[model samples]
Target: MASKQASVASFVESAPPGELSNVVADIKALAGNDASLLQSLEPAFRKYNEEQYATVKLPGSSEAVIVSEHNSMGDNRYFDTASQTSFQVEHSSQTASAVQQHPLESSNADLIRSLQKSFSKAAAEHFPSSVVGIYPTSSDSDIAILLVANKYSPQNFWNGRWRSTYTLSPSSGGLKGAIKVDVHYYEDGNVRMSTSKDVDVSNASGADAVVREIAKAENKFQEELNRAFVQLSEGSFKGLRRQLPVTRQRVEWEKIGGYRLGQDIGGGRSK
Candidate 1:
């Protein structure tokens, strides 16, 4: 079993630019809308969160920042600020497999690997201040008991964090039997019910009864994963911006602020 770190590192370092399209296509093929790669990454998060880990990268010049921002809007809305892409390239007149078979052919695989290494080195040099490990994702129902702290009663939407993440390969039985349980954070900072089968984030039979049960029970989880799945496979999210706060009929943020009411502030105004 290749360490997920090694695999991720490889993806970051060796993936090619033009190959992103094909890679995304391959991911879509594998998870079928399992966007953000979470469809295949939750298992790793569960296992690694117990003992967090991170790369030794510096900031400023780093190519990407593995950022972690918390949204306490009674929901966990966390996402990686790191660049979300990976790819492999084939430059010569021959395919990668052909290159491998023909050994001595001048190929693009080497160039691809070189590019990835450069990116990786740049990342480590710049993002030295970033978190070492334990990006978050959640399963709402499992944390039902510890609700008061959030001031967020079971609303129509999910009230948990999202980790826009991915892994080199799907866990367990590929995507089918991947055993990543959803983790519930407590209002009091305790780990709540970590359910075995993410009520909504699982794949059961296509039977109507099963789908219905999964829907009612894992509504939020299912919805979020589905959205990410779509975003990752489809290359973008359909953003619906939140309504801006109402502006007082005459209130202006810029105009009044320039005029200070203090001493000599408006001296050259209207003599």
Candidate 2:
């Protein structure tokens, strides 16, 4: 039991983002419906969710310690911080099979594949190291595409990621789509923002045309999102925080403690 638990921890610690579900599924298979064991793993998952990876490692796998940023592109990146060795992790055959059989691929496999190819090409060109995945939705005609871009700059004390999901489906106009964009920018501190918008792809007449239109719509959507992010970062956020006190500065309570001292009347302070 101890060995099994340690193996579970090892997998969780070394597993990269976009591949954790597969890890969990494999662990569950070994545990064989052990509810308590699954429940006990919650803390490990929570720590990973909180982006705590300073001590992440995979024992007996590599002599060098692995340093990974949560959701960062490329697995096993910067495996050794001292020498700065960038190690790329190879997926096991079992893991590869799990990825190929993603639950989302069960429905509308062809459409999902089409969108995956289109988005993957764009991602490779425009957003290097990003991962693109397409999934089928409950609705037969609706499909969802998820694109993740992550990076970390330790020298600058910042780590950030962009997660965008687009849902495309048939509509009266032509092809209807909606996009949800989530950004987390952590520089000295974390600042998160999310936004969503609905878009229309017109003039989608045939099957091939529909694919082309969807791709075009996604490009346009990304452009608009880019502008909006810039505005928020350069204009709105700065304006809102310009007057705020610096986070690192200490407050001198002794100096201003008596400035607004409440008046005592009849042994009680006035409201």
Candidate 3:
């Protein structure tokens, strides 16, 4: 019986080291793969959470920007995050007068639809992975447009919360022949930055020309918005970080953790 016990212990000691080591390595590899998979899936999960709760608190109801969350769910979920930030840009009466015979003055809905189509096209061209939506105000006094850039990736590791909101209205008096633009930008639900500019498109000839001018202004604002995001992400606005609300801080913390883990694991695998 003692010999039998001794034989069993010897067999166990003689087992291959590579077999046990390989098993341990495989377990670690699986853990790493799980972390990677979760990292890859995080964007979609965040988008789902955002859509489920991030309803834009508009002053009134408008269907133009109320996109179906389910329909927009997928790889580019950042494009679906709803924006609460908004501001207005007013077009002068003189510009309207110049186009009095134009379709915009005749039907406000038509004007909103036209601008939506033009702006949506331009946004797509400028931001390849962006989602654009335009909604006319219930009172017809203004139109709100949202642009969301879907640039989040586990590999590249960005928060992917960049968005811009533009509100367009009809200007009064001296502002005629120009579009007074109030642009608001949000990152992770915080209004971290904004800019206001008067775009002089008085020289624009026709309706199409006017649309082109607006698109140009939108593109310019978008460029500034992108720059502001870069500045904030690079820790240039450390002072502003202290002012962030608790909700925003939580969002930012999660994003930072996710990206840092992704970078560490990615670097480890490469070595």
Candidate 4:
């Protein structure tokens, strides 16, 4: 029989790339059966929070100071203040409470409008422009969340369950020079919420121009995601009794000849 260490080593070898080192460390600790070894891993778990904070910067000022560092379950929120603007960065797992919320049973025009107003207010206050477009990647649930957050009714909410991409452009009577935000859902149950803006500030020279652009984009992305999460949690969407069960299925069509489809099978618990 192979030793426990040997077995763990084999498992680590076959594990997915980027996960091997962590897997090896975990297995080694388990094999040792020592509580202290497990405790030591806590620092590794916290490394992400530190690294995320290191990338944070305040716009328009080099003298920005850290205002607060709030730590929650597997996540951290850092607030930094400068002369012109205050900035915050939330580093959290995809499964963070802000990202995962209960789905809404139904939606209405008034509710949608209210959400849009809130989103616009936050965007206008934090960025150069409001969110002019929302691109959904992989999940319509995100769009549903967006519609519920923005107070805009999704056109085909009742038109059978399917995913669609929405573009709110200036040509379509939306806000001109509006920031573009993308909401992406990952298989690891993580959400990648981000935003971008076009910058053409006049009279700004050298690195200051580049720094200002980056600061604007980062602040916009952070504020949008944070505000959307808050909206989703505020009794607007119905909460699930427990986490939704997720399953993946592969379907092959012999009649269609050489066609294969993959589907994620899950839904909110029936009321």
**TM-scores of all models?**
0.19, 0.43, 0.34, 0.22
Give stretches of model 3 more than 4 Å off: 1-107, 171-211, 218-271
For 135-213, candidate 2 gives per-residue lDDT tens digits of 4454556654555565655456444455555455534325565555544455667655556667666655434555566
lDDT of 3 at 88: 22
- Per-residue lDDT for 1-271 in model 3, tens only? 4464344334323222112233334434654655543334333333332332222223343422323232232332212112322312111100101111112222345655565567677767766555556555445565555555544333332223334454555432111122222222333443322234545444543335545666677667667767877988777677655655533433355456565443443444432
Best by TM-score: 2
* Clashing pairs in model 3, backbone N/Cα/C closer than 3 A: none
Candidate order by lDDT, decreasing, is 2, 3, 4, 1
Candidate 4 lDDT score at position 132: 19
lDDT of 4 by residue, 203-232 (tens): 322223323443464466567767877987
Query: TM-score of model 2 relative to the true fold?
Result: 0.43
Q: Which candidate model has the greater TM-score, 1 or 2?
A: 2
Q: After the best TM-score superposition of candidate 4, give how far the Cα of residue 61 lies from its true spot, in angstroms.
A: 26
Give the alpha-carbon lDDT of every model.
0.28, 0.51, 0.40, 0.33
Error of 3 at 71 (Å): 17
**Which stretches in model 2 have alpha-carbon errors above 4 Å?**
1-112, 138-141, 169-174, 202-211, 225-271
Please report the TM-score between candidate 4 and the true structure: 0.22
Candidates sorted on TM-score, descending:
2, 3, 4, 1
